[model samples]
Target chain A: MSGSRLSRRTFQRLAAGTALAAPFVRGAHAAGKISIGFWDHWVPGANKATTDLCNEWAAKEKVEVQIDYITSQGNKNRLTIAAEAQARAGHDIMAMPSWEPHDKAKLMEPLDDLMEPLIKANGAVNPTVEYLGKADGHWLVVPATAGSQIKGPCSRIDLLKEHAGVDIQALYPAGSPPKADAWTMDAYLKAAQACHKAGFPFGVGVGGTPDSVDTAGAIFSAFGAVLVDAKGNITVKSDTVRQALDYYKQLMAVLPPDVPAWDDASNNKWLISGKGAAIMNPPSAWAVAKRDAPKIAEQLWTHGAPIGPKGRFAPFVPYFWGVWNFGRNKSAAKSLLLHLSQASAAEKMVAASGGYDLPAFEKLTLFKTWVEEGPPKGTLYHYPNPYNHQVLSMAGAPAPPKIAVQIYTQAIMTKMAVRHFQGEAMEKTLAWAASELEGFMRT
Target chain B: MADIAVSRAGTVNGAGGRTSLHRLMQRKSTVAFLMALPLITVIVLLVVYPAIYSLHLATLNKSMERFVGFGNFTFLFGRETFWLVVKQSCIFAITAVVFKALIGFVVAHFVHNIPSKGQRKWRGMLLVPWVIPPAMSTLAWLWLFDPSYSAFNWILALFGIDPVPWTGDAYWARFSVILVNIWIGAPFFMIMYLAALKSVPEQLYEAAAIDGATWWQRIWYVTLPMMRNIIAITTLFSLIVTFANFDIVRVLTAGGPLDHTHVFATWAFRVGIEGGDIPLGASVSLFMVPILAVAAWFILRDITKRGNEA
Candidate 1:
C-alpha cells in the first residue's frame, strides 16, 4: 500500500475508536464520581468485598463512585502494575499493599488534611500509619486494615510437652503466653534438635522462598539483624548476619530434613497433620488447623518469637495503605480509607477474611479471637516484638522485597550450606556467600 | 535503423498496456487487503509492537532510565547465579527432551502393538498426566514432596532408607523438576510420534519381517528415519518450552532451598520482575533468545536435511 493511503486509514480508525470511547468517558465524568482502578486482591474479601461495600456506602452518600476494578494475577504483580499506573495518569484511588509504599510514593498524593480529621474523630488509629503515609508532613495514604502482631508459636504443644519432655510454662514464666521471644537462639535450636532427636520434625524456614524468608526474618530480627535498615541502606554485612548464619547452621540439623526443599506453605500442611512439631509461624495457620486438624488448632497459640540474647526483635508486616495520588476519586478513596480505618469496619473485614486482617490499632478493636483463629497465620509463629521492632522499628521498611535478603543469604552467602547438604563443597559455601552478599549489596 | 526504432516503440506500447492491466489487478487486490485490515491491525498493535517493545526493554538498563547496549548481558555475566542458570537450562532442556522422546517412543510402540480397538483406552489412560493442569497436578507432586508426609519417602522408607528431599538439595530439586516435566510432556511427544509411526507404511514392516530382518534393525532403519522429522520438531518445541519454563519451577521450589534450583526463567523473574529491576530482568530474559535460537536453528537444519534426502 502507498504510504499516504495507509496513513489515511490509520487516522480513520483512530478517529473511530476515540469516538466510541468518548461517550462512556463523558457519561462517567457527568456522574461526579471518580473512576478508580484497582485489583480485587488487595483489600478484605480480597478487595472485591470492600469495593462492593464501598459502592453500597456510595449509594447512601451524595456522590457516587465509579469503580474500575482489575483482578490481579497475584499481589506483587498487582502492586507493580498499580505502581506503574500511579506513576502515570491511570488510577486515582488505589487500594494497595504498603509493602513497597516508599518505592511507589512518586505517584501518590499526600493526605495530611484527610487523615488528621479521621484520626482525631476515631481514637486508636495506628500512629505509624501517619509516619509511613506521610511525605513532607502530608499524607499520601491513610491507614487500612493490616496484619496484626497477635501471632504465636503454632508449635505442636502436645508433641513438645509429651515427646521433647519440655515444659512450655517453665520456658517463659514471664510473658502472658509462654513467650517464644524470650527463648534464646541456642535454646530454640536445642528444642528443635531435641524434638528431632525424639522423632519430631522441626520447622524453620531455610528455604529462600517467601515463607523461608519470613521465618528467617522473624528469627533474625530477634537476633537484632536488619537486612536493610529503615533508611533504605544495605546493612547485612555485620555480626548480626554472622550470628544468624551460625545459628541457622546449628538449627538446620533439627529442621525437618525436607525443610531445605520446603516451599513457603509446606510446613502448614505438615504441622497441622502432626508431621512437624514446632513451626516458627503465625496464627494464620490455625484456619487450616481448625478445619483439617481441629484438635491441633485448639492447641495452637500465638506468642512473640524468641528474643535473641542480643535483642528483642520481631518481623512485623504492616499492610499499610497508600492512596494513589493518581486515582480518579480522591474524596471517595479517602472516604473508603476512613471507613475501613474505623474500628468497626476493620473488625468486620477481619472476621470476613477468616481473621486474616489484624487490627492496625490496638486501642480500638478487640482482636483476641482473630489472633487465635485464622488459616495460614495460626500454624505459624509470631513474635510480639514484630510490633516493636519490625513494625515499630520498620525492619521491613527497606525499599525492596525481602527476596534480596534471601538471595544474599542462601544463594551466595550460604552456598556452602546448600552444597554441603547436597554433598558438595561446604567450606566454599561460606566464602561464596560472603562474596555473593558483597556483589548483591553492591547493586 | 528507422524500421528498428518504429518496432521498438511498438513493443514498448504493448508492454505498457499489459502493465496497466496488472495495475488494475493491483487495484482489485486492495479489497483483499481491506478484508484482512483488522487482522493486520491487531497483529501489529498487540503482537509485533509488544515484541518490539520488549526488545526495546531488553536493551535498556535496570531503571529503564538509560540505554545501555547489551549492558544487561554484561551484568548477567557478572552474576554467579546466571552461570548456574545457564548450566541448569542446558541440563533441563537436554534431559527433559531426551526423556520425553524415549518415554514417548516406548509408549507409542506399546500402544501401536495393542489391538487397534484397545489402543483408544490405552491412549486415553496415557494422556492423564498431560491432560491434567500442571498447576493442579503439581499440587499432588507438591504433596508427595512433603518433608514428613512424602509418599516418595514413604516408599523409600519401606525399602529401609531415609526420605529424600525430592525438591530439596540442588541435584534432587533439579531431578524432581525434570521428572515432572517429563511426566507432563511425554504424552504430547507420544501422540506426535504415534502419528508419525502410523504414517510409516505397513508394507515396509512386512518387507523387513519377510526377510527375517531383526526388530532392532527394522526400528533403526525404518521407524527412526521415518519419525526423524516429527521427533526433531517435537524435541525442539519441548526444548523451547522447558528452557523457558516458569510455572513448574515457580510452583515447586520457586528457585529455592537456595538459588540452587533457579532456572533461567525464575532467575530472570527474580532479577527483573520481583526485584523491580526491569532492566536487569530484561537482560536475563533476553539471554534466553540466543539459546532458543540455536536449538531452533539446529532443528530447522535437521528438518531441511530430511526434506532434501526425501
Candidate 2:
C-alpha cells in the first residue's frame, strides 16, 4: 500500500472511530433547533412575556427557538396535541392542559430530573398538579405558568352588598387573610336568589362546558360528593352527592334560565355586560371589563370561594409543558423549560397575564402581581389563595384519571344537576348518574 | 378461392384489433383515466383511506393497542346519551331539510316570477346566507341568540314580550340549531330549484292554461312532474350534508343543556377528540354512514325510475 493510503487494518479502525463520533457530531448540529407550542393566553400581551423569556434563553444558549401560541378556542390546541401525538411529530415542547399530561403520559419524556430540583427551589407542588403531571410514578411534564387559573368567585362588590347583603369585602379583605367563616354555601344561595330577584342573575352556568364543569366540581368537592371514588368505585348514590344536587337545583333556579346552554364565554360576557352580580372565573373577565367597561371593572373583586359543609374547594386547572420523547432536541427543550420554571420567569409570566395565570408551586403563588393588580387596589390579593385557606382542586379528581377524565369531558356532574333541576326526581337523577358512571368505568 | 378470401379478411380483422389493443395509451378511455388520476389519488388518500382507517380504529381499544372488535359499538348501544344523539341527529336532518326545501321552493317560484332583469339582483341577494361561511354566520346567530346581550331579545323587549330562551331550553336549543341550518341552506336550494324551474319549458304552462287548468293545478300536475328529479337529487345532497353537520350545533349548544341537543357529529367530537377515546369517537362517527347510505340509495332509485319513465 502507498504511504498516502492507509493500510486495511488502520482504515477499519478509523472508520469505526468516525462512526462512533457521528452521533455526537449530529447532536452538536441539531442542538440549535427547538420548537414549542404554548397555550395562547387570554390576557393581552401575555404571549409577549412567554416569547421574550424563550428568546432570552435562546440567545444565551445560542439555540434557534420557534414558538407557536396555540389557542384553546374550539379545542384547536387539543386537536393539535392529538395530531402530533398520533404522528409522533411536532414541537419539541408542547403545552398540556390539566387532563392532557395524564392522557399522553406514555409518549412524554420523563422529567423527574428536571422537576425535582425545581420543586426544591419553588416549594411543594400542588396536589392537583402532582396528580395530573405525574404518571406511573414519574413526572411527565414541567408545570407551566401559562393558562393555569383558579375559578373563584369574582363578584360585583356593590351588587353583592346592596341586594344580597353580603359584605364580600369584609369576608375577603384586601391584603389580609380571608375571614370567610360566614361565607357558607347557604349564604351563597341566598345571595344568588336576591340577585336574581333584582334582575341581575348570578350568571352561574349549569351547561356542559369547562366553566360550568369547574364550578360544579368545586361545589361538589365542597359538599364531599365523589361520584366516582379514587378506587374507581361508583359513589354517585351517596348522601353528599344528593346534597350537592339539591343545592345546585336551588342555585340554577336563581340563575338565568339559559344557564344550561351557556358556554365558557357566556359568563365572561355576563360579568362584562353588567348583567350578572358574580361569576366563578379567573381574572380574564375583569381584565376585559377593565378595557371595555371600566365601571364594571372598578366594582369587581376577586375573592375566595364559599365554604361548604365539607370544606372550601377552589377550582384550579394547571397547564403543563411536556417534551416529546421523539423530539430531535430534547435537551434544549428541557433546558428551556427549566429556565421558564424559575421564580423570576414565572413571576414575569404571572404579571404579564394580569394575575390571571396561577403558578402551580406553593411558594410562587405569593407574587406581588396578584397583590397589586386592580382598579380597586389589591382586588386580586385573595385571587391566589394568599393565606392558603382554601383547598385547590381540579374537577373530576380523586378518581382514577382514566375515569375522571371521561367524567370531566362528558360534563356528567353538570348534566346530572341540570336533569334534576329540570324536574327529574332526585332518585332518578342519581340513578342516571350511577348508570353513566358505570359506563365510564366499563370503557 | 372463396375460402382463402375469407381467411385473409379474418386475419386482417384480428391484426387490426391487436394493433388497437397495443395502443391503449392513445385510447379515449385511457386518456380520461389519466386526466382523472389526480382526483382519484386525492379521494383515496383523503377520503377512502381515512374512512377505512377509522373503521380499523373503531375495532381497537381506547389506547389503540389491542383490538376489541365490536366492543365500542356495543358500549355505545347501551348508553342513554348515544340513543339521545341518534334521535336528535335524525330529527335535525329530516326537519331542517324538509323546511329548507319548502322555503326554497316558494322563494324560487317567487324569484322566477320576477322580471328577468331584476331576477339576477334578487337571486344574488338571496344567496348571501349561503355565501357566508357557516362558522362565521353561526357566530353571528350565536350573538343574536345570546342569553344576556341578545339583539333579538332587546328588540323583543321593546314590544313588551319576554326574552325567548333561544338556546337555553332543550326544545329551543334544538329549534335554534335547526333554524340556523335552514337559514344557511335554504339559499342553495333556492338557486338549485330556480335553475330547475328555468329548465321546465314555458310551453307546458301555456298549454295547461289553454286547457283551462288553474295556476295551482298547473303547478301540481305539470311543474311537480318536471322538477321531481332535480328536487330528489338536491334533497339527497342536502340530507347528507345536514346529517353530518358539526359547526352549527357545536357552536350553538355543544350538545348541552343536559345533552338534549347532542347530535352524532358533536357527540362524536366530544367523545373522540375532547374525551381522548379515539375508538369510541370513531364508533360514534361510523353510525352516520348507514343512515346516509340508505338515504342515497332510495333517492337514486327514484331518480332512475323517473328516467326510465321519461
Candidate 3:
C-alpha cells in the first residue's frame, strides 16, 4: 500500500498537460484590449499617423488599441482572397476596399450593431441608400470616410500653357472647370491630337494599362457603353466600342515612341518629373507630387475625369472602410467604424497621410488651400475638381447595363482596341468592333 | 496461491475484459495506434474533412447553402471562361516544365564539367535563386516588368534597342512571366541533374569514349540515358508547381490588361474568394485535379518500373 500510493509518471503527465492548457484557456478570455487591423504603410490616412492617432484615442478612452498592420505592396490581387480566408478564420476588425465589403458580406458584422444612431442620424442612410451603407440588403459595411476619386486631367498647367499654347485659367474658369466633364471620344482624340501637333509628340501616357485603359474606358463609358453588366456578365460589342477604337487608333499615332512600354507609375512619375504634360490620374498624383517633387507639384493642376459624349461622365470608383462581419467584439467594432468614418477622422487621417483628393464621406473639408500647406504646398493647388450631386447620382446608378452595351464594349477592349494598338488588324478592326459590341448587347 | 491467482486474474480482466473492443486493443500495435490517435484526428479534422467538404461545395450553387448536384460542373463545361482557363493552365504548365528541364539539363552538364572542387563551389553559388524564398525573388521579377522603371528596359537602353512591352501586351506579358519562371526554376533542375550527373560512374563516360563516341554521342548514350530518372522526376514536380503558379501571375499582371493571362487557380480564386461565388470557385479549382493526377501517375509509374527493373 505504501509503495502503490501514487504513480510518479501519472502525476508528471497530469502536471505537464495542465501547464500547457492553462495559458491557452487564459489567452481566450483575458483580452480587454481591441485590435484595429489596417493596411500598413500601403496608403496614407491609414498608416503610422493613423496608428498613432488610434493609440491616442485609446489612451484618452483608457483602453488599449492594438493595431495589426499589413502592407498591400505586391499582394494586391491576393488582398480580396486573403480577406475571405481571414473572415472564415475570423477578423476582429479589418479595413478593406469598398467593393470587397459588398463581396464579402458574410464575414463582417452589421454597423447597425456597432452604432445604430450614426446610420439613422438625420436620415443620412436613407438619402444615400446605395451611397453610404450596405449594398446587398445587409448592413455589413459603412463608408468610413470620403470616397477616393481619380481620373483627373492631372496636368502641368504651366507645361500645357507653355507647350500647347493654352490658357490655364480660362480653359478652367472661375467656377466651372473646362475639360473636366465627359466629352466625345472624338473630342478626346482632338484634344490629344492638338497637343501632339503642338510638338508634344509623346504627349499622353500609354503604358497600355492604367493610363491607356483609363483614357479608353473614359471614352467607352462616356459614350454610354457598358462593358460588363453590374452583375458581372460579359458584354463584348457596342457602338461605343467602335467609336472608342476609331478614336484610340487616331490618338495612338501621336503618342510617344515608348508609349507601349510605359509603366503604371510612369505617367504619374512623368507628370511629377515634368517630363510630360496632362496625364489623367487620381487625386493622389497632386498629393504625392506636392510632397516629393515640389517644382512639378507646384505645376500640378487637378480636374475630374473628362465628361464623355453622353454628357459629363466617367467611371466613378467609390472607396471607403467597413467593419468585417464576424468579430469578437461587436459593439466595439461598430464604435470604431463610426469614429473612423467620421468626417473628423477622415480629414484628420487625410491631413496626417496627405495623398487623398476625395473623401467618400461628404463631411471632410479640404479646400484649395489644403494642398498649399507645408510639403503639400503650392504644388497641389494648380488643379481644382468639383464633383456635385448631379455627377454623383449618375456615377452611383445601381442598375446593370443592357446586354447589347456589354458585347460592344468587350469587342472594343479585347479584340479590336488591343489588337489595333499592337498593329495586327488596324483598318478593319474599328468597324467590326463597333458592330460586335452593339450586336452583342442587342443579343 | 489462490490469492495470487485472483490478483493476476484481476490484472488481465480489470479493463481489458470490459468489452470485445477493449480485448482486441490489448497489444503493442494497439498502443502505437492509440498514440497516433491525435494526429489521425487532426488529419481528419483539417485535411480529410475539408477535402470532402470542398467536393460538397463544388456540387452546389453560388452561396453553397443550396444543393445543385453537378450543376456547377455542367455549367462550367459551357462557359467560355472555363475553357480559356483550361487552355491557359496547360500551356503554362507544359511550356514551363519543358523549358525548365532543358535549361536545367544544360546548366547541370556545364556545372558537372568543372573539377569536383569547382563543381562544389558553382553548385553553392548557383542555387542563390532557388535558395532565396520565392516571394523575395518575385519582387525582383516585378521590377523587371515595371512599365517605366523596368530594369530590363534600362539594360535594353544600354544596347540602343527599343524596350519591349514585357507585361503590357497580352503575348508579351505571358512571355515575360514564363521567362521569369524559367529563371527561377532552371536552377532547381540544374541542381538535381548535376547530382544525377555526378552519381554517374566516370567509368561509363570513359567506356563510351573508348567505344569511339563523340561529345554529342557520349551525352546521348551516357549522360541522358543515365540521368533520365532524375529528369523525369524533376519535370513532374515542376509540372505541378508551374501549373498551379498563383504568385507570379497574380503579383505581376493579375490576369489583366484584360484577363488574357489568367490560369485556373487565379481565376478560381477571383470567382470563389473575391467574387464570393464559392461554389463556382470550388468547381474551378477542381479543374487542376486531372492534370496534376496525370503528371503524378507518369512519375509514379516510372519510379515503380525502375524499382521492378532493378
lDDT of 3 by residue, A1-443 (tens): 97866799888998999998975663422535676656554355546656666666655555557776655454353464354544464446666643455445565666655435554442243222253346455566665443344454665666557655555445554344354332334545565666677755434544334345445555555556555555544443556555666666677787655455454566677666655666766666666776788777766655444455664444344444555545566666565666665555665666554545344433333454454443423333323233242233222123232232233122235345556776766446644444433333211
By DockQ, the candidates rank as: 2, 1, 3
User: Candidate 1 chain A, which ten residues in sequence have the lowest lDDT sum?
Assistant: A378-387
Worst 10 residues of 3 chain A by lDDT: A389-398
For all the predictions, what are the DockQ values? 0.32, 0.69, 0.11
lDDT of 2 by residue, B1-310 (tens): 3212233334455567665554555455676788999999999999999999999999999888899999999999999889999999999999999999999999999999999999999999999999999999999999999977789999999999999988888898899999999999999999999999999999999999999999899999998889999999999999999999999999888887778778888999999998899899999999999989999999999999979988
What is the lDDT ranking, best to worst? Answer: 2, 1, 3
DockQ of candidate model 2? 0.69
TM-scores of the candidates in the order shown: 0.80, 0.93, 0.77
Scanning candidate 3 chain B in windows of ten residues, the lowest lDDT window is B1-10
Output the better candidate (1/3) by TM-score.
Answer: 1
Interface RMSD, in order shown: 3.6, 1.4, 7.2
Clashes of each: 45, 0, 49
Give the per-residue lDDT digits (tens) of candidate 3, residues B197-265: 889999998898888999999888888888878888888889988988887777676665545678888
